[model samples]
Target: MRTLAPVALAAFACVAPCAANPALDALVAAYPDHLAGYESNDLIFRDGTRLPIDDGVKGKSFEQLLDAPDIKDQFAIPYPLGTANLRQPAFNEDPGRIRNQAMFVKMYGDCRKGEVKAQMKAVPWLPSRGGGTVMVTTANGVADQLAKVSRDLEQLPKEMTQYMVPSSGTFNCRVIAGTKRLSVHAYGAAIDLNAKFGDYWQWSKPKGGTLAWKNRIPLEIVEVFERHGFIWGGKWYHYDSFHFEYRPELIALARQGWPK
Candidate 1:
């Protein structure tokens, strides 16, 4: 993994009040196949469509953002990288949780209409750890990035192997559980590790009005994913330890210390 230089860390420590970071910038720049750039609070598309950066709703409940989110709404919660496990996250600690359906569908193509398959490329999982082949999107070098992640992960200690290999799945075009919105998996840019060692909020009973946060995925594995422009669901308040999705926006801001 590339270490964060002390000077870079110092610059990253300062949070921008209402500006996009390099990670988001990278996402926009990387995906010229779909997007144009950001103009004020909107995501400009090459097709001349402008998607708002936020929904203009401040302080929304977690459920609201999930059910009804605008492009801007996706940034409502900041994703925390490199943090220790928490017993419980404050309500709405769902980083990379708010997804704008229109934005994603525009970029990745809606699978319901059978437009997603063309961009997919097969990638091998942790081959050294006995993992098999998995499919991911070739968009914005996603396939190449995952290959790099696989190569790096293979070099880790044997003890860290199980958490990464014997993979769960990749590239399923489907709605998220309990919602009509398509999952990142539909884009073929996300992966779920071994399900046996994963912890999901829906799988557990809620304590009071909140679900307890639990994780078994190692930080070392997470660092690898982040280095390759993926974000871990374990960082969410409604944590899913095995989940890692390609979300360069959050990763860039995280590197800049926006969502600490």
Candidate 2:
């Protein structure tokens, strides 16, 4: 992980007021157990650690944000929820893609160091579809939420089982492809549905050209997961239709009213 220089810290320390930032408000509200509040430019944790909200940079390219993002960078792209119509995401508009690594490490525990596996618990997948139990983190009630999601998904049409049955995976301790950054899976907060229907950016990438978005996951399934606080990767420009991560903050912001 990259560290911010003292000068950069001082520059972004002037965080905007809470009332003026619904995204920040949602973030604080989403993880009440770990976060105390936000002040000036720092996100105050319950443990008394203050992380700088921004990195004192503006007009950051998508690559830059993906490589080294602070808290505010996570909200650089406003997520659009309650929509099912298939459409292309604007270039590099990956809402939940730019995560604040330090913040997540603090909230979910580091997997590489064995801190994450300790908190993991098993949750049953679509039982009716014969999908067995999958392990996920218990942090932030993720296992509980996933249980709820599974129950709801099981109620879907029998045909939908093909897409949900035999879940691709839930928790895995590994970095993202070709990057040192830890994936959400490393923290046990994300899951991939059936691999047979999965669509990844790299696999679909044409030789040297713009990244195209493709998805086979049904909107009904996506809606069910979103209703339970999971954000679908299908919404990203670099789409991963089969992936969903527990990120209640983005859902809360979209529901309450995201900035236009």
Q: What does candidate 1 score on TM?
A: 0.84
Which 10-residue window of candidate 2 scores lowest in summed lDDT?
6-15
Candidate 1 lDDT: 0.77
Q: Which candidate gets the maximum TM-score versus the true structure? A: 2
Which lDDT value does model 2 have at 259? Answer: 79
In angstroms, give how far residue 125 of model 2 lies from its true place: 0.6
Model 2 ranges off by over 4 Å: 1-20
TM-score of candidate 2 relative to the true fold: 0.90
> How many steric clashes between backbone atoms does each model show?
3, 1
Clashing pairs in 2: 15-40
Deviation (Å) of 67 in candidate 2 = 0.9
Write candidate 1's Cα lDDT for 88-202 as tens digits.
Answer: 5676588888887888888888888878899888898887678889999887678898999999999889988778777888999898998888999998889999898999988
Model 1 collision count: 3
Predicted candidate 2 versus true structure: per-residue lDDT over 1-260, tens digit per residue: 12344434333322344334677778877877777667768887767699998779988888889989989989888788966565788777788999988999999999889999999999989877899999999998899999999999988899889888889998999999999899999999999999899999878855466787888888889999999999999998888889999999999888877775
